[model samples]
Target: MKKLIKKNIVIATHEYATGFPQHLRSYLSDHSSGNVLYIHHPLHPELREGIGSGYEWNSGKKRISSRSTRPVTAFGIAFFMKSLFLDIWWTLKSGKRWDAYIGVNNLNALAGVVLQKFGMVKKSIYYTVDFIPHRFSNTFLNAMYLWIDKLCVKQCDETWILSPRIREGRHRVLHIPSSYDRKQIEVPEGIWLSRIKQAPFSSVSPHTGVFVGVLLERMGLQLVLQAMPKILKKIPDFRLIVIGKGAYEHELKRLITQLGIQKSVECKGYVEKFSDVEKIVARCAVGFAPYTTEKSGLTYFADPAKTKTYLGCSVPVVMTNMFHNACDIE
Candidate 1:
């Protein structure tokens, strides 16, 4: 057995959501028996500000509803600058040499690369948390990200990834395939049973599936809406209850009406608690992930928090092959 190195650690990543970081934190909180330091770049307040159940997809409830300045051109610059300042401030104040500085997101990794320059932090590990090159919001952003990605792999001492596809693509990226360990998610038995007992079943039908996650573009909510009518025809009671909100929620609602599945589907936007999702998932017979091939860059390369949450709740899932480690269904 390889002896694990016990040391002080700093985990840098994006803010909380019903996404990767939330699940990662659930696991890493007790990881390796070492003191864990969490450092995050300031995320939009609209994205945070909720607890259990309310965040289980869109619950049709508005949580925080505050908008932040989303500057496209200067996003990277601003994010890097702010995160760099926070990181340096935290590390200096701690006055301790970090045994390992792990980046849970690409930008955070880049910040670590910046920290490694002072020649004090040892073993800066970059986690290729999502598919970057293919998921950039714009062309220029994509170009800049590609360069930053190169720096992360080239400049960091170790790199960690969640998928074989990403690892294979970045063969020169000098990283270990640490596919975001999935063994740590544990909902307390009392809470789990209570949520399951409290779950509200849909009268629509049994063939319908529920999708619970942030309603983002790359996640393929559009495809789910597009496929709803077809799925309804073939599988009656095949409604989709979308839980969560994002940049594409309004357009998705429009598409829902345009597709005429308004009665069949519900857009429960932004529940303030995850316990709501717990109930929603508990009642759901099947979890849906209709991520399309071309738009599946991030979905294909990263470990989805939704999939784990679904399985954790004993709900079988239907996800695309775009996701890695997806089990073969009978």
Candidate 2:
């Protein structure tokens, strides 16, 4: 008889509701043969289930949970208890008997290390998309996050980092740089690649610029807005189309009006389909990744999805010097 693969794998991630986990799972499912279970808390179980796909990561709860912003609030306590219980449950359920396990992100990696305490599994891989503890918080929080990351690095058999900068201080740890997914990284199969080969987004004027990605504060929207007047002075027809949405949408819009550049700046908001992203990017001549400089270690190791998407579409980019993933282009 031909040898049969009997490994039971678990994929732990926080991106159960997003495309990151979906794409990663799709790749894993194609390559591996065994029982592969995804552990995640589905915030929108109803909608996810209605889609008739196993992509749902619901914790079997009818009501979705939220975190309170107050200092030492009851909601914070409840949230931790709930999250801890879920983690313990998954650990016990997937531990011991499984042949291999993989965890994505720092939080999930910590959970995998904890699961190893049960003395069941031998191989556990930790994959980090970016530096976590330094991403959004202040000094104290960053220190605490670094402590947790140390524990994860010490426990895992192999660690996959997304950027070279992240491998510092942990040289002995087994590290792999996660490359852009080949399947999702391919150019569109149609006239666009040919058009790009000919003139590269002929629909857009040579001066027009476009940015696609989550419109969050860390992305340095303020800098891009500040740079607008400078760019406009050089190129009169210079226009910027902002895609994606977040907390600062209205504030950014107001800043455009304050700067009196409303006509030249357009905030197109969030997009649902990959094709929509391709279409929006196809209408621009230049792409921009204007991440701000901060002490945050997270920004130093970012592999912005927008960076790869723009490159795949054959659009040239102007990115921050501090951005790690776009160094080749820089």
Candidate 3:
């Protein structure tokens, strides 16, 4: 057997516990030869140091404790402003030139480009998860976001997108033509080998379903709750297990109580590992991913990661036609 050659690689993304970043890390660990450094931008302003908050750093197999960010507002404007600067600053301070620098979101991608400018990174990759023009409510902020997105697309050495529709949308909406075609656009899709191994056989709960995704309103989780009352009438012992956390979690719980389905539905908050999610989902009869079809939402363009995870678990997935893979699901 030949020995694997190591590459110095770094990744920057928001500390969201979404499967994408973790999957990226796990995928590289298994296939690529590299020393990986992962950095995160905290979503909330009140992230603490020791609580395993998403803002911490992990390099290779070792976990490195990082200092906490100062508080301000939700989504923390300061974090957004400083994320790119710090990525470059940290790279320069390391006194090392990275073989590849991958940034998950547009802001992080911009950091990768800036690192390349400073000669700190050999290659800069723009790994965009989703793209929507009206992502922010503020007009100025939304415009700025779009500008940064276009800049990253033009500047980065490579752009890794989730779906092909996103590629079309960028050209149609942003008027940015694809220069390299196949070389420029790449889709890194695949669950881990264990997920590919398929979940173990278990006693399926016929009247029970599981939800393992973000709790965002556009994710359409509330619709399932609204319809659950009717579902309860059919299967009196019907149950729903909701795993994952997001902005809509409070509203979801409130709606559950409002619908008087508290005993019927269980909110498991956030699960740290997809394997743990599989443990809960594999035992269920079906999985749910009722995302909305709103044009301004990420669901309209990108395939839902939760739905893919559910499919990997070998459980039936009930999803809306708002995502890219809806037509293919059948």
Ranking by TM-score: 3, 1, 2
Number of the predicted model whose lDDT against the real structure is largest: 3
Model 3 alpha-carbon miss at residue 137, Å: 1.5
Query: For residues 1-330, what per-residue lDDT tens digits would candidate 1 score against the true structure?
Result: 012224556677655454444544444443445444556554544554431111111111212222233322333566556665666556555556676777766677876776677654676887766654455678787777777776676677776666655665544332423342231121211123333443444532366578887777777878878887888888866667788878778789889889888988877876766767866776777887767675336776666667766766667788776666665431
Q: RMSD to native for every prediction?
A: 8.4, 8.4, 3.3
User: Which candidate, 1 or 3, would have the higher lDDT against the true structure?
Assistant: 3
Candidate 3 residue pairs in clash (backbone atoms < 3 Å): none
Q: What value does the lDDT take at residue 139 in candidate 2?
A: 75
TM-score-best of 1 and 3: 3
Off by over 4 Å in 1: 1-6, 16-24, 27-34, 42-76, 135-140, 171-208, 230-238, 272-276, 326-330
Give the per-residue lDDT of model 2 (tens digit) for 1-330.
Answer: 011133555666643223455554554555545555666543222222322111222122221222222222232335434544555465575433555556676666676777667665556767766664334457775665576666676677767666655664234222322322221111111122432322344565677778876556778877888888888998878888887766667788888999999999878765656567776776678888888776454566655667666666767888887666455766
What is residue 57's positional error in candidate 1, in angstroms?
30
Number of the candidate with higher TM-score, 1 or 2 = 1
Model 3 TM-score, all chains together: 0.88
Cα misplacement distance, residue 45 of candidate 2 (Å)? 14
Against the unseen true structure, what C-alpha lDDT does each candidate score? 0.60, 0.58, 0.75
